[model samples]
Target: MVANRTRRLSVRNISVVILVLVVIYALVGFVGLPWWLERVLPERLEKHMGWQAEVGDIHVNPFVMSVEVLDLDAEDSDGEPVVAFDRFYTNLGVWRLVTGVVGLQNIELEEPYIRLDLLEDYSVNFARDWQANNPPAEDAPADDSDSAEPMRLQFDRFRVAGGELLFRDFSQEAQEDFRVTPLDLALNDLATWPREDSESNYYLLAAVGSQTIEWEGDLSIAPIYSRGFIKLGGVTHTTLQHFLKPYLPYQLRDGRVTLSTRYELQSADELFLTTSDGQLDIENLGLGLAGHDDELLTADRIRVGDISFGLNSRNVSTGTLDTDGVNLSLYRDADGAINLLEPFRNEADEEPADDSSDTDMPFRWTVAGVELGNSSVNWRDEQPRTGADLSLTDLSISVDELSDQLEEPVNYKADATLGGGGRVVINGQATPAPFTLEAGIAGSDIVLAQFGAYINEAANLDVRDGSLSVDGNLDLDQQQDPLTGTFSGAGEIASLDLRLGDSDERLIGWQTLRLEPIEYNVAPARLEIGTVTLAGPTVNVVRGGDGLH
Candidate 1:
């Protein structure tokens, strides 16, 4: 009986010990742990980062080994919001600890927001601020040992939903804003540990204004390789014009671009990137000169297809480029410089630092074909006369092949109608290196009245009303330093009326004046005229401004 009583006493003591342990666990996990975290986390973060951090609430679940932080806000020194999130949750997978891997069962972030600014010198605000606030520590003595092993980490699933990023650039004179809203990201089976299946899958979806962006990819970190498909749908020019402001003086008034590409990247001894099956389309593009109402360039559509590029080899190739209904306006100022090219001229004046090493690895690019249809160009020149305007309409151009290597022949053709009921055609095959061209040029009923300003500027004469027709074949070769070329052509001017520039007196008149055949050769430096025919011709002798005749 005494032994039984001693056993009962031992059992009672064990039960009391178990009850005390339960009470302690409940107090720490359910009551004290979250409060302690809420009080300490803000202080720790501010002390280390020099930024203000706020935590609304923290909850710990002992049963699932999970923790949740709600309503977290982090701000910069200037009280600008850097990062804020509504809810962040993570669950610990304790079993992975046996294999020296810190594993996360699941991690979720909801409604996270980030704000970033880029400065004029291309430095980002967050980085500059952080570096300024936290100076680097002094160098320590080097240890004669191998570096510490990298921590191994694994995540079964990670997700972000309803995220937003506000990006602003102060690089330009005015601030530019770009926002990505409702960004969703997901990743599965991501691990930094050695495993049979090391590849992770990821998907991203986001929108900027009306544009939608999507990316889905498979990545592996051990070997550092990734393959992905990316698409940008209906990105408008207004949303992206700020990116081009530095390079262009014009404003993008209207345009939308759609692009899709498949890409693969590998990081080994040298980084390499390969892209294929790319397509880009631009629709309804209109570019207007800054502070001007008229469009400088406009296009209905431009399409680029079958694009492929390799970064390691520095090669790029495209199958076809097609553009339709393009209209361009070009202007030349009194200084004999194109107004549209002023921006590029200014940029060129700021000479780039020479890098001779880059010359050894030149880029190789080629386009299989190019086609432009239903295009027009309006040219205005303000030299030696009140601005003369010339227009070429209903233009179509085609190039069969073009490449950086200039050894091969490129075949091209162009056809256009002049402003006043005339047509011009040119077809040619050209080699760019030694600069050789064999071509035929023809024009019919080109109006001479429209060329009065040029005639006055060159010869001090005015062309009132006339029609010109020409058919020519030219073979030009610049293989030698001096030009070696031959031109054979026949031309006719009919119903011609000309007058002196200083006075409204007729100087010359002609009807159906023709040169039957004309031939010129560079080798012998000679010109041969076959014949001249004139139906009616008249001329008047006029004294020049110098009073010679």
Candidate 2:
């Protein structure tokens, strides 16, 4: 009878203990814990993160192992809001709580507005916050030490929807507003630990100005390595032109531009930028002086494709770049200035371009090849009375091994169809500093009338029935103390007739003229002649005018 009573009392006692424990758990998860945390979390977060943080209506759902915070607001010291969001939801794993560590499985945010501003002298508030949050690189010794370990944050996934971002640059005199609406970002399976099977991936989409940007790829957020493909759809050339009006020397009136890039990166003192394929396209682009309306140059189409490059500790390299459909006009104005290249000359007092190497940067680089195709160039000279037009069609350029700190020399080759039915071919090789070139110019027949402007510029003469040919080699070295160069060639001309610039009638004629092995050097301005031969030369004398002898 006593044994039976003991068993009954023990069962009743166990049931009472279980009921009390269940009540306590319910109160802590549903009301007590969330209320206490919401009251203190704002101040604690603000103090620890060095920013003002406010939280409203936090709810902890123990049954679902989840927490949701509604209406979170944060601001920086300058009273500018860092971020404002309608809702932030985080999912938790019960196993993590048992391990006494705060770990999140998924974090989702709704409708956040984030702003970034650039300040003067390259100082920015975003940079301060980034440095504050990131681990000190200086503290990590260069030597590999087991004792030192970087603190890593762990999270499974992160997502943001219906976001808006704004950026402003106040560093320069020209201030432009940049914004992206309906910005969305997502990442999944992110972790501090490196795992081969890690399916960490991300995607982003935003519209800034007229450009729509889309990015998708794999990423590792901690210890930072990422690979992504980006597509920038058709940016408006007019918008870019106005935005860049301040610093540019010429105005861009119209164009349609698109770009795409595939890249991989690794974060280190030495950056590794690995690109698989990249391309940029522009069509119907007009180039002109900044304030002038008349277009100085225009291109029907331009394409740069198949670009691949990488930079790392030892070297930098480019796979190949193909440039096509480049058409433009070059002109000399009445002031004897070539408009194509005149605007780029910088004054001596202005700051020079930056060529300083980062002491740790890789010194060697190679461009595997570059090709220019379907290029047509037109040059016109409008110097007072001399009106001349020159055209080069069927023009193509090729370069190979263009490199520094490499074993092979850089090679360049050009083939072009010249005006007056002439063809020119040139080939050269160099260490990229000092170079040598071999060239040839030949045609069965060339008209001197088409080269009238060159004659007037060189010898102040007008000519008819002119024919010219040259087979030459040249060597140049600008790296020398005073700059030295040499050119040697054999030249020939046939059926040439010339007259003084003031008179149109021919005064001199030659059936054939030849110069063999003529050489010249520029450091001391020396000329050496091997042989000069003239054939069937004739001169006509005018009675009342200046005549040829």
Candidate 3:
């Protein structure tokens, strides 16, 4: 009986050992199953989703498993290639693997390159093709209502360490149009849903070395929309401003832009803007008809203030110009060839009138408080070398060129105030080159010494409570070298005085020489004088070739 019992015990022990071995075999085989399973898993998925798939060698250990892709090139229904992955690997959860559960711990894609082509028609059918082959479910709606919910694509971590995205619009043929190059983009937060309807928006931050572009804000897939504010700080202010200028509604090729504000849209072909403070440094600006190649009018610096501007009928117009603090320097190259710098006090060149057969050209200028302290303009050829040291306050001048003889002579006027507390009024016709005058001298001493010197003569002059009126004509006739003209002056002298030449030829007396009763004329080479007409002059008159007579 003892022998039989011992044998029974051994048999029971053998049976228990066999059961333990079977369980161990099951566990070991299950844990190692993914090695064999992964080989065919990718094939099954490809067939199911209508994608071409290939797999690399699979690595398996008791605790971990990994599967890598040797190559993958799949196409959507549109036959557009999606992505090319150099190497892709996935790590399996060892705990789940031992229990027969199916899933991966994490998947990693290394250097996956993708190319997308967007058309101008705004149709994104490539995505539709991708979805068709890999349908989500029968209950899924046709429209992208789920897209509003947000899109999340996750991975252990995807790195585009070195890759490029080529996007092109094949429809454009014009060279002047905009084109986008292959931008190297390193993306993160791809797994997070991009906010569409939420008040808080989503963003993508990317960098290429020192240069960085942060594209933050809301994005909508439907209707194809995007709205965001861009703050560019990394690059130099000049370069950044230049790159941003093209996006502006107005062209600023030759201008110093201090600050600017702009708003734009896709559908609307118009742009609204407000400029804070800026100056345009342009040699010349042209404005004309759309197809007409010639420039209708031109100016030196076209300034728009802390100046508001608008584009209407293909012409740029200033809504409000703040000229109080703005200054524009203009240089003109006349003769269309001669290089010259003409700094005008003010200039405005408007478009030629459309209806009027003969274009009416008018120019206006204002030189407030012009201080000509010892300034001179010298002419070499028979032209007068003009020089003056006078201060003119509030000088305004306007000239209009007419085609036909008008009811009134071409309007010309220059108004200013002299430094001697006297108001100067000058009004004349534009045609004869406009003659002006200086008047209103009361209780001021008139110095006739310079006048006498210019005419090679001497005279004693005094004016008390008197009026000095001057009138002149300017002839622009080219026949005469110096352009002959006449200038006349008359003044009232309260006390009479007389003196001519030196002491030997001087005629000094108590005779009253009325200032108003005297007239003077200057021609090409002759100085003519009218009667002095004093009330009490019994003096004899003398004449010489070069002296006052």
Q: Which predicted model would earn the best TM-score?
A: 1
Q: Write the per-residue lDDT of candidate 2 for residues 19-58, one digit (tens) a residue.
A: 8988889889999988988878777656555678788789
lDDT ranking from best to worst? 1, 2, 3
Model 3 is weakest, by summed lDDT over 10 consecutive residues, at 370-379
lDDT of 3 by residue, 1-549 (tens): 999999999999999999998777666645555456555756664555455544544444443565555455555434555556666666655565454444455555555555555544544435534556676788876886765754332332233334444444333332121222223333232223333434223444433334344444433332333444333223322333344543433233232222222212222343333222223223333333223343333333323332223322121222222122112212222232211122121223655456653325532212111111111111112111221223334444444443323332455455555443344555555342332222222223333232333223222332212323333333323234554444444444333334543434335343344443333333455545555555554354677789956
lDDT of 1 at 45: 63
TM-scores of the candidates in the order shown: 0.89, 0.70, 0.31
Q: Per-residue lDDT of 1-549 in model 1, one digit per residue for the tens?
A: 999999999999999998898888877987799999998888876766667999999999876789999999998888889889999999999888898988999999999998988889999877787677678778956765558777888888999999999989888888878899989999998876446646798999999888999999987776577799999999989776878766667789999999999999988787889999999999999998766687889999999998999998889999889999999998888989886775567678687978666447898999989999999999889985745888999999999979998978899999999986679999999999989999999999999988777888888788888999999999999998688999899999999999877767777998988886989898869998899998888888967699976
Q: How good is model 2 by TM-score?
A: 0.70
Q: Highest lDDT, which number? A: 1
For model 1 the local lDDT of residue 174 reads 87
Candidate 1, clashing residue pairs? none
TM-score, candidate 3, is 0.31
In what order do the candidates fall by TM-score, top score first?
A: 1, 2, 3
